[model samples]
Target: MTKTLPLRSYQFFLSIIFLLFSAPLLAQDEGEEEKPKLTLGGALRFNYNLSSWKDGQKDRGGDFGYDMFRINAVGTYKNIFLNVEYRLYSEAFGGGFLKQGWMGYKFNEEDQIQVGLTQVPFGLQQYNSHNWFFNLTYYVGLEDDHDMGIKYIHDSERIQYQLAFFKNAEELQFGSTSEIDPSRYSYDIAGRNKEINQFNGKFIYKLGKDRNHQLGTSVQYGGIYNLDTKETGDHHGFAFHYEYLGEKWNVKAQGMIVDHNPITPDTISDNVLQFGAYGGTYGVAADFNLYSLAVSRSIPVEIGPISNLEFYNDFGFMDKAEDDFEDSFMNVTGVLITAGKVYTYIDYAAGYNHSWLGGNYVDDFSAGNPDAKWEARFNINIGYYF
Candidate 1:
């Protein structure tokens, strides 16, 4: 069912890129008003983990290790702006990757466009979860997903809209014959099937006296090209989300339906597809319905260096289309502590038929075991931001 990008759309993307690059020259002709400003910031983080599934680690108390070090740069020159973030992690966790790098141009106070490896306009703007481990949607490439694309954004007092066209996922090596690269920051189709020519659109409306309530919907469609068959298939998804922000409480809820029809070889099953990220590849159900809800309450206190505390619980469930496939579930109950430049997350995360939480590595999200036991992990992540 996958279709090629239309000729007109292709030309439109090119035109937008041309305009984005030519804006500075046009601004110079009109006379520059202010100088460009650049800012640099970064964070260093560490983690301690105790897993009920790992007997050795439990016997030794736990394991503490370096988590991540990231650098971010932001610059603006009149109507033109740039944002870039790169991260470094342990070798086992995708050594390093460019999280996001995009250049943008503001058409006016309400409209702007960005081109580069930009975050996709999908469910939830920045993230769907407040914890260090995001919701299950992230594992399936729905939450906090980014791609090489051009995006247009419109922001008003009560309405927000976004549209984007991504030619493909980020390529670490150009013209490489390898079909899969596990060393990445975001999950994507990385086996014999590859994602390409994706389009996304999202709209949000704010209500309430303070405009603190938001209701949004998003849709995405893309081609999945199978290297073995050399035929492009298709994948699509739709999401409905709502959020409410109060003085001391926040709530987010979302529902999504995702389907993938990859034209694979006869030997491979289409019920599950391969997804890769963080230096590993795993199987994910091709068709599933996902639902997630998160709630948090913030409390202010003066305790030594700690200034505030936020407690939250994020829960997600995945129901596969295949009748025999076992469902997946995850929940993270955590508290975030803020102390000046330092922040810490203490969480007890549990999962059933989930990949990262427990169960078999590659098959957990695919043909999950019906009798899989619940696995839990106690984790603490501390980070210093500057």
Candidate 2:
């Protein structure tokens, strides 16, 4: 059963925005030293999806939905800065929220440290997909991942690096549930065994005469604490990233393997392995490997509302640790049309052996039969950032 978001909570969320926006006017008389510069911005998105399953069932063509709304506040004064982002999701699976909140201090031009919730430095970091649904690594918790932690970052002409230690991974689910709860992107592994005592590090080096080429590597280690068993699950991850940015073309790729120690093979289940949550599906496998690549080129011409356009194709693949499990692949061809603050993504995505690419294909995985499958989705994502 689904319930509407609480009225009081929604009102409070709006009130905070109003207060933040009005604060500058209320303190116009304050000195510059005391009043930090405040900037408020965010993005609103909507998605219309048409999905086809392996069984030949097609969803209604006009399956329109309010995807998400985000509000960001940034305050900077001297060497100190604070950032906060609040996100409100529409009621489909249930209204879940809260994205990012952190504070940082810059010691000098090339060094800084941040505390509170921030993104985990892993895989491709920001990712390279124009589609609203990213790649397999994202669904399995390896890309665009965030956690509550402290991070130190260093940047220079030739090298950039990040070292972070986190207390716990961020929670995505909203209520208390003993049952498996899967979100659109990833499932809540923290629900059963929270990821704690996490450490992540990454290093990047600039190459080539134009300095437009980059090569990087990342490592992550964390412990999962099972509330019921009072046991610990050890997780380790390693990856390499490469990217080249030219005048009108860009290419990005990443490959990583995430391994969790002590997974019993018999524990694998449909609900557990689909989203690839730690305590769920991955808990039954020793490890999984993921690879992603994307190439895109910017178009010179512009359309009416579309000031600029770029075409892109993204490819991703995943393989489980056990030899019996079949490998999965996802291929997405899309275009991004940008107009000032408004950006829209028009995509056609298809996949084989895994439903995590889109639609309801993942529910069919089994040990006895080799599940030969085909699934696809036509997705349009429109967003305005302000």
Candidate 3:
């Protein structure tokens, strides 16, 4: 429902009256004898891929020709959170809005306040990890690209802060055409049919003597309507980041910028799409237990160079940055190796334009399939925890 005016419609009806009075504070206070403590959980993931191309031919490994599928779920209490996702990405339209959802709220211990539909923070390993359905540009579980509205956060020990607002994740990937490499890269991202609005903010710090070696920053702004421009011309986004998180050794660096305008309307346009582009990246991950069998390796400068050798004790990873429709500049990378729980390992990548192919992968969507190359994925799952 994105058609002119109503900018934030009075803060979207005051956050729907605080979610209808926060639904009676989720009931259960009563005399308050330290009862209201809840923590339930759920998670499942499945994935597959097969690649082959022809049509025009050049893109050696993939261009939406092969095959794919995925399923996901998540839930948390205390601060309040819930999420679900499903996909059968056979490639092409990428996956055609399968099923993805998110809800959140958690304003303390630092701070937090959430809305609905999620993803699209593009860093800190996609916000904590999940591997954006195989790193499809692993901005970390990918653009996680979901939309609805409202989000705020603050965390401390050193410090970190976040802010968000949305209305469209209508298939996050900036434009729409799902171009992993369109001949010479491409983007015309338009496929919301209204409901596009966004805002994002982030900060993190740790200066003096070893605060786990840290420094971070982020800012995102959004809007992409274009009811023939009467929607006051939407389409715009900006991002910047820096990182260094350590326990055993971890490092990351980031960048992003986009602005979509000029009579933008879904289903490809801009004559063939090409709005804005900027990129930067650097990555390093290290953790080894060996006495208990734990391993890891990462070289991220835009998807390329990955190594994981694990028997497992525990391991984790994340990455996020997205704007599909092939406008160029994407991020996603993920890894999880856990042995304490039977067995586990996962990986995915869809990143390129690390300021300009620093690690290379998407080489112009095959230029019509010039024996295309660049389609990666890996998954291994075994579980428990009730």
Q: Pick the candidate with the highest lDDT.
A: 1
Scored by CA lDDT, what does every candidate get?
0.92, 0.68, 0.40
If both were scored by TM-score, which would come out higher, candidate 2 or candidate 3? 2
Root-mean-square deviation per candidate: 1.3, 9.1, 19.4
Tens-place lDDT per residue, model 1, 1-98, is 44576799889889888888887677675554788999999999999999988989989999999999999999998888999999999999989999
Residue-wise C-alpha lDDT for candidate 2, range 1-386, written one tens digit per residue: 11223456446545544544454456455555664799999999998877775234353345777888889999997667899887777555345545678887766689877777788888776765656667666656676666777788898889999987776656545334342433323333433555657778999999988878999999988766554455566678999999888888889898888776433234533223223332234322336788889888998666676777889898887777667866677788999889989989999888776544443333422121264666788889999999
Candidate number with the higher lDDT (1 or 2): 1
Where does candidate 2 stray beyond 4 Å? Answer: 1-34, 54-60, 171-188, 262-286, 356-369
Candidates in order, TM-scores: namely 0.97, 0.80, 0.30
Q: Single out the weakest 10-residue window by summed lDDT for candidate 2.
A: 360-369
Candidate that beats the other on lDDT, 2 or 3, i.e. the better one: 2
Q: Which model scores highest in TM-score?
A: 1
User: Against the hidden true structure, what lDDT does model 3 obtain?
Assistant: 0.40
Candidate with the larger TM-score of 1 and 3: 1
| Model 3 per-residue lDDT tens digits across residues 1-386 | 43343646557748754863485477436564442443444333333332222223234432222233444566665456666555443334343343446666555567656556555453443532233332212321123344456666677878777776665544344444332221111122322223355566667776656776556655554554544534544544444544454444454444444434434546534422321111111221111000001122433232222233232112222122222312222233445544333223444433232222223333231111223243433333433322
Clash statistics: count for each candidate: 0, 1, 54
